[model samples]
Target chain A: SIIRILEERTEPKRDLEGKKVLVTAGPTQETIDPVRFFTNHSSGKMGYAVAEAAAKRGADVTLVSGPSQLTTPFGVKRIDVTSAQDMLDQVLIVYGEQDIVIKAAAVADYRPVQTFDSKVKKQDGNLSIEMERTTDILLTLGQRKQHQFLVGFAAETNDAVAYGKGKLERKHLDAICVNTVGKTGAGFQSDTNEVIYLNREGKEQHLPSDTKKQIAHRILDEIVEDMEADRK
Target chain B: SIIRILEERTEPKRDLEGKKVLVTAGPTQETIDPVRFFTNHSSGKMGYAVAEAAAKRGADVTLVSGPSQLTTPFGVKRIDVTSAQDMLDQVLIVYGEQDIVIKAAAVADYRPVQTFDSKVKKQDGNLSIEMERTTDILLTLGQRKQHQFLVGFAAETNDAVAYGKGKLERKHLDAICVNTVGKTGAGFQSDTNEVIYLNREGKEQHLPSDTKKQIAHRILDEIVEDMEADRK
Candidate 1:
């Protein structure tokens, strides 16, 4: 009865009752020492929003989140994670079974190759962390996608469209949301975000700045539309 | 009248009127491309909380914040910044005049040596951002401090006390707030924090987990005590 009430309120036309969705949010830390790590300013707000929106639309949602203070969305399965490797482990487990996948995590590009078990002693001179390339989770997911509608986020400070499109093509993603970070009232640490969506068919739709929750719903709407068209 | 009301609310015994305080908060961005940059997940809560507390206590507070969505604290003059160089310029401008200086911004240790004017093209293989050391803002401030009570933040995940003390000594800081980040509700995105304080005399004090606002007031209290101690 409770499930029926939730499903009914979601509206049958936009219902995703049978769909399985997987989403990733936040920043994956790259440990330098037992007490120190390299991480980016990803608040995980957008990813959680997307996950919440999908779950509300009746999709069975699995959220793989990095360390954040956000409470889990209702009716969504959550997997807490820390490092990039930790994220990969959790995501790969449920990725193959999902009908849709969205990766919004700002994964660290490089990590300290030498992870000190103890504290890294401060030297007299400039200290450097020798970094090595981390596994490209999106790229890997891109390669494995068959029936899934895969989405990725590209955070740029300049040329948002060009970079977003490039990532869309290179990663074999169904769609990509591109936004410039560090602008006033936009990106990382902000409640609102402005993003441009680029699809595999070379179509671009610019979504005006809005709360991350609103944007999340908009993105999900597009995915629903695309999935419906494909079925025909 | 409003000034008087604010003044009356802030207990006269704790008043820092006529005192000049400077605080740095948020994460400094390091440019990689015109559209991309490297940054850390520093929410600037602790720094902002400190600035807010000092301002409420009648201090003429100047908050130099990196890119963040936080609202400016009342009675505090806010200076927005983006990169490490940007932070340094602002801090240096008023360093000589400040009675207290708190370096809470998570400044990027290194920046891409070569910054692409446009979007950096994604290649078939791994992409590497060659990084070079940025200015050590804290170390420079420590060297330059004469009458100012300089404070710094050391975010560690392990050996917090030892590493924090080491940083305090090497940087010649008047005091340092050392905390282990990457733990649940501890650092970066959390509203609460647990920290250990180390002063120039090698004295150590531990602060239990509490709201950033409470912790901020505690930090200000310690700075006030030490400044008063130094006056005699």
Candidate 2:
């Protein structure tokens, strides 16, 4: 909807028409047991925003998501997953083929060393959760890139921009959006977001706090511009 | 219901009549942000089992719990809590007034050092959750004991008996129940449990796996026995 409203005010270049785009969203639930999990679920808002924006711009979008209550946006291909392993499994299935990939998911970094299929009892003093790191999805994608532009999102409470730039280079991302959360209407479940978008050449685009829908279009517009420039 | 169904063959002890008892249950939810939390809600099945059994035996029972889908058993006073801090706050309020306190809740040992009141964005790289130890509710209650008896639980995966004994000594608990979870139909969300009912003297009474309701009665039977022994 934002894309439709935005197109009327600007020339429609159809920049992303029929391009294959892959997006990831939501937080992985590391299972401790049937009912208990190790970490929080990422609300799929930001990933959904990006995916919706891409779809609106006529991209063939494949959205790999973690468990969430949010409905899939119109005209987006959605694949739901449960754990970090599940997300990874789903992601690798489509990795070699996308024109662009945006990793907006709050991928859980660690999962219990082993997930007990059933209930786990509390040992008297404390029951320990042995954690191990999950595979870095974005880094893997960057390494295996073959004509695809990769974008990643960074969320932080402090030192957002500095760390974001560091990751941009380390992950070899084409562009990265650094989101500093904690202010009203920013991060998590809120409809609005404020982000600092940066490119490989160190150009920064600071987006003011606004609804996710509006922010989505701005992010897509930048990516399209860079894509067009690279084509020339 | 177990009590009602089991009453067909035995005399009701009403052993806990007129005694003030408090029990803690469920998992503590550590808030990472407004919409996200760390860890699962302790099922509170075992705690509810104990509280309900006490009420059936005529004890003035108070049940402090974390977020759960289970309903409150009849005649038990229930106070719901969210985090470890909240559980401690609730426990302290009734600690001095109770004749017996059972620390059965699966209390979280660590919580995020800083919790954002709003949503937290995912940093592109691994987002870290800095954790710090929470207050030991059982140990604090044990230290503040005057004329009251304190019971603590130890749930462990390995060497449960050894760990339970260690905590019983460390917490100065009058009685302790060591639960061995990870077995089928045992621990969280299950209706059944198996435990070792023990005391300060190192005496242990083994309880076979049974419905939590049945186990609750067995646990209380031991407590009542110990209480009578102390009075004599």
TM-score of the B chain in each candidate versus the native B chain: 0.92, 0.94
Put down candidate 2 lDDT per residue, B1-232, tens digits, no spaces. Answer: 8966676567657889999999999888877665456666357899998999899899999999987668899999999998999999999988889998988898877676787865654434444456667888999998888988899988776788998888888888998998877643245767888999889877899999999888999999888888888999
lDDT of 2 at A159: 88
C-alpha positional error of residue B230 in candidate 1 after TM-score superposition, expressed in Å: 3.7
Q: lDDT, candidate 2, residue A36?
A: 57
lDDT by residue (tens digit), candidate 1, B71-160: 898889999998899999999999999998998888877766776655454434444445677889999999888988999999876677
Worst lDDT 10-window in candidate 2 chain B: B120-129
Docking class of 1: incorrect
Instruction: For residues A81-112, write the lDDT of model 2, one tens digit per residue.
Output: 97777887898899888988989888877766
- Candidate 1 chain A — worst ten consecutive residues by lDDT sum? A120-129
